[model samples]
Target: MDPASHPEQLSVVNEQVLNSADRSVTAAVCLRRFLCYGSESSTYSTKECPLGIENALSLMQLIEGGRGSEVVDEVRRFNLEGRAVRPNPGLFTLAVCSQHADCKTRQAALRALKELCRSPVQLFTFVQYKKELKEGSGMWGRALRRVVTDWYNGQDGISLAQAVTKCKHRAGWSHQDLLRLSHMKPANDNIALVCKYITKGWKGVEEAYAEKDKSEDLQKVFAYLEAVEKAKHSTDEQELIHLIEEQRLGKEQLLTNHLKSKEVWKALLKEMPVAVLLKHLGKLTANKVLIPGSPDIAAVCGRIQDETVLKKAKTQPFNILAASENYKRGHGKRSKLKWEPDRDLVQALDCAFCKSISTVEATGKRFLVAVDISSSLSSLCRGSSISTVAVAAAVCMIIAQTEPNAQIVVFSEGNLLPCTVSSDMTLMQVAGLLIQTPGGSTDCSLPITWASENEKTVDVFIILTNNQTNGRENPADTLKMYRQKSSVFSKLIVCGLIANNLSIADPEDCGMLDICGFDSQAVDVIHNFALDIF
Candidate 1:
């Protein structure tokens, strides 16, 4: 009798594997949840993924025992350089691994603090996580003091002033509280003025420093800061627009009322990042900032198509696709805002979606892309209207478009049917067709078994699913038998549509990959894995 065939036996075996797994395996499993689902809201008591958080802290301790900084390095890389949809989850894990838990010294934590906290928002999230975890226990410890102090001293004067003005307080802690608790002595006069502004506002800057206290040339650094202070109180729309254009104030620095001005948005559009521009297309169009044949239309369309800007912002295909889907509806998904989307702008977004997708060099490998039509996959992805089946369809379309020898199919209990696809269909249309697929239980092994029975030559099998298979045949064994029958080694790639711990990929199979979330990064991974890039 095979113990792996029994649920109780398999559960015990899986537990043993998890317990004995090395730091690398443990870290991957723990970080998978964060990389997919973001951190839980502070309004709630329980975490978004408590098990993942527990495993993360445990992994940190395991790595710290070996005097390694692998977890820290991974978090830093994901937050700073990777095309992550959200950075706060990484920041939360980094805070857990860094400040709350430590090794002999605070080197890893300090390094992450200095490197990852690139902006005040990131710093606030990091500090908020720390506060939520410890609740002021050792919040004033020497190690934390050093971490906070070094973070402030690391930035230049002008940049630091702008950072301070971005966010006043978050997660029940203000910069004033941090500075006071850390006892951070400013590095210089400019730093001193910035610190004063954080603690006491512009009046504090005036009270602390006289006109002649600074060196003649050094006082100019605060010119932008002075403008920001004045802009906060100015009700004149023209004056606010002038300040934004002249000083290059970020959207975050603008007041609530100021955002209603079309001219202000136009001014901010000149410097808006691609990701931000994609998000506010509805508002921009409704406010008449982006219209048919307007200069702003050309600018917005050009920025969306700018390869360098998209790459720099790490823009994801799903973002552009989602924006297009929402924009084409002529109304906001969650708000009452409405606009007539420009045909040119919509075309630019669709073009950008394809261009933003990560690609790999085709290796002429035959591919079978199977999408699960299970009832669970019909449910919407968290925080988005894109259903899991929609994600599967988008991924299927991607493979068919990129690979020369790729077949697309939808699978349901013991059934595998070829899906009709056209080259001219938009991503949204493909998604709609897939979502309308009759929801049923999934037999994940159907694709492998059908291919084996038909003697179809397949090099890579890409399955997009929620992994909630209710079929009798085991996927791993089915793959093994198919490989034996076909006399050809084949690989399987499972793209998980939701954040869960389930995986159908065999642990020992080097050719199989279980990736969470169907994003551009996952597409890159699928392509590389198909080519055996590892």
Candidate 2:
């Protein structure tokens, strides 16, 4: 049976704290719950497919039945009662609302996420889109250097010319900061206008330039503000910020792509219903097309230089109908290959990625991670962690799988993707060696029981997942078998993530010292969790 088919044969707990409790206490409680009951609450009706706002609760309740119905109702009751409770729930709820088709729901989610930025964890979300932080050796670098160089200089006029001169020798800079800088305006007699703008507060800069707009972009924005001001009802700052960012997305036209992708985006845009002024700005920004995917594609090409070798790999395209066709477009090709792909195409490809993503960066500490993608992982793609999951998965790909020279193992029902150091192979190249497929159950014991049945002194066996797990037979059965076999060594560690309030039995099954949720600094968590497991 699919391991997911059962309530993971695990124990469970508090489940209530997520909604009404203090975030700090809730955070701590949630972790403890996972440690205490890490596996419990098993039964038929206990499990029900989750839906809407009450989703995560339903997942836990699924292992329990008529009581499960009670669980669902309780979750809803908690929701309504807590209407006056924690505002953070809004942050958690909006993410799941992506599944909803209405614009109001989506807008709410986006707004909540934006508000989360004020929190310390804001940097986690920020890291994903930050392709260019204030780094050196580029135009942006020059721009920043320019600002730092003259931030204290010229008590008189700090012209754009001087700023440019400062950055002329630098190589890179922060695009976001630079963009913010460009929007700052000075007062008529404001000595060192930049400093003046900064001192007078952000409103001062916007107000100073609010009326004297030079570009069409600024004009549309001013008009939007005017419209909003005319409205009798005042909107909150978050609502205003959401509209502005929407305009930014529309302006960049980043969503312009395939028919399906475009249609979905358009529908979402309408559902979001930004002000006409915001929509207008989006359209204007959309029109200013950036260089089409060239530099990014070029960088990718440089990563994989073997033309002949890469050509052979494309012999298979899982999705493209014309994937198998021999296609190339280059100076040295036989028959001048038609529509062939360029190198560094992994960005678009759904291949297995590892943690060593920044090959260009320095070497990182090495470690091992063993994950059971058998079930439970559905949590990563659900709840407030969904977006975080994708980003985390990408990071992991760079780490674990990126090292073709490292030893790696992936186990799931009757199958395993395992590698050993051979004379001709390096573990760093392992991620490139296997294709991942989600198996139905945590039948990992089948192969493990076979391999270590007679061996001793084995390395670590870490299970990376959301703590809830159910097996066809019993995960415990495998644990017993594990103990019975193995002439050498055995150490087991289970990393349960966001599994607020887990339940477990036979304390021995869980080698972890009652840990729950995830702490990013733990090297094991860093190496094992999906790149998307943020």
Candidate 3:
């Protein structure tokens, strides 16, 4: 279909098509710099291959066909030849790229990242700044970090998941190696050529490439190349020609429009079990911290599992500098209830009132117990999942083993089931209680107030939350409610599950014992902080 023949949306359609340099777009920009600077230095960060040079020229031609002047700001922003040594490069990178003109910033940023590709010291610095990279970032940062971090660490510049898909089995690459391959690189050496140079040297791709299943795709492609090389010794000319053709066709398929292998996508989706693509898409993106280009993009990305469609999106290239899906998870008042997220729950139980390791042999007499309604925690109901339900139940069971005489209460939508905890029965039989109801409004103070007033036997009142309130809008009023209850009672631990970025205006904020990420090893974090109540 000729783009010119379209009556409407020609411009829009063109925007969807990645610039003609294909998958090697990022490498191309780095190589073109050679023409201007006339040198490829590993230390200075401007190392471009011949193929890279060719791809960059093609990208330049596309931008020039529109408005060349728009790209000037892009060159200024992403230090195309400069270094991002700061704590949060993603934040600065996105700010510079988004407003600097579309494709212009994309290529320039790619070049800037490539320059730092070959240095081990630079890679270590990235790991040091890991928190800053994730804290306020979007999906773009994840994408770039996945690739760049691997390269700096001397890995193959791709993600682990990608590696699995490419090789069809785990190869020798570590997590860092996969991350390195996920992005492009600029160094010109083979052993340390970075992604840009490697892609160019191997595939004649001048531009950078981002495959949906980058890890797996690259490994599969590379393995074929290796096999063909070895086959030259034994395979005849006719056989060699057949092998070459197969390799060429395989390479085309590897680099072309197919996205993640269907098998891999299904495996990921299977983790959700009962959740459909519609529901789990948002869940996975939220957990992975990926944000689609627009709300529409988020919506589409969340719903579609189509490899071709996802591949196009892969080419669109997520800017890890955008707003993350996790920014709002427990943003102030939502997860502030009386229950822990999965990891936190595990931590609270794993440490037996000690800041050390706790296995099944964790000493006698459990000192802590956490309980919530089946509807409140179960995935079979609303706003929760089966996994979380299992997590909350696990907390109670851990207590039952250690304490033997621990008291546990399991609540459903309305009925509350109280059980005596003993080593014989660990997991609660609350699976039968999952049910729908008029969603009950929760109070930050109610559960704690009740526990403080009633459980005089408890050594420490432990509460877990996502740092949000259901109806308690006023933070002070809620705190006052707990304070009044606590005035008579002394022992209490207020733990918050910071599912997202929970900004505490005061470092010594009232009642903040600890803040845990969603995946923060629950038992480990509890023990690490020495806050476990025996």
Model 2 steric clash total: 87
lDDT of 2 by residue, 73-149 (tens): 22233333321122222223333332234545434434334433332122222221222221222322332233323
When 1 and 3 are scored with TM-score, the better candidate is 1
lDDT of 1 by residue, 478-525 (tens): 887877778677887766666444467665454566665555445545
**Which candidate leads in lDDT?**
1
TM-score of each: 0.78, 0.31, 0.32
Q: Using TM-score as the measure, which candidate wins?
A: 1
Off by over 4 Å in 2: 1-355, 358-441, 444-452, 456-459, 463-524, 527-534
RMSD of each: 7.7, 19.2, 22.2
Pick by lDDT: 2 or 3, better one: 3
User: After superposing candidate 1, which stretches have Cα over 4 Å from the reference?
Assistant: 1-53, 57-105, 213-217, 358-367, 373-380, 387-390, 400-407, 412-441, 453-460, 465-467, 480-534
lDDT of 1: 0.68
How are the candidates ranked when ordered by lDDT, highest leading?
1, 3, 2
lDDT of model 2 at residue 115? 36
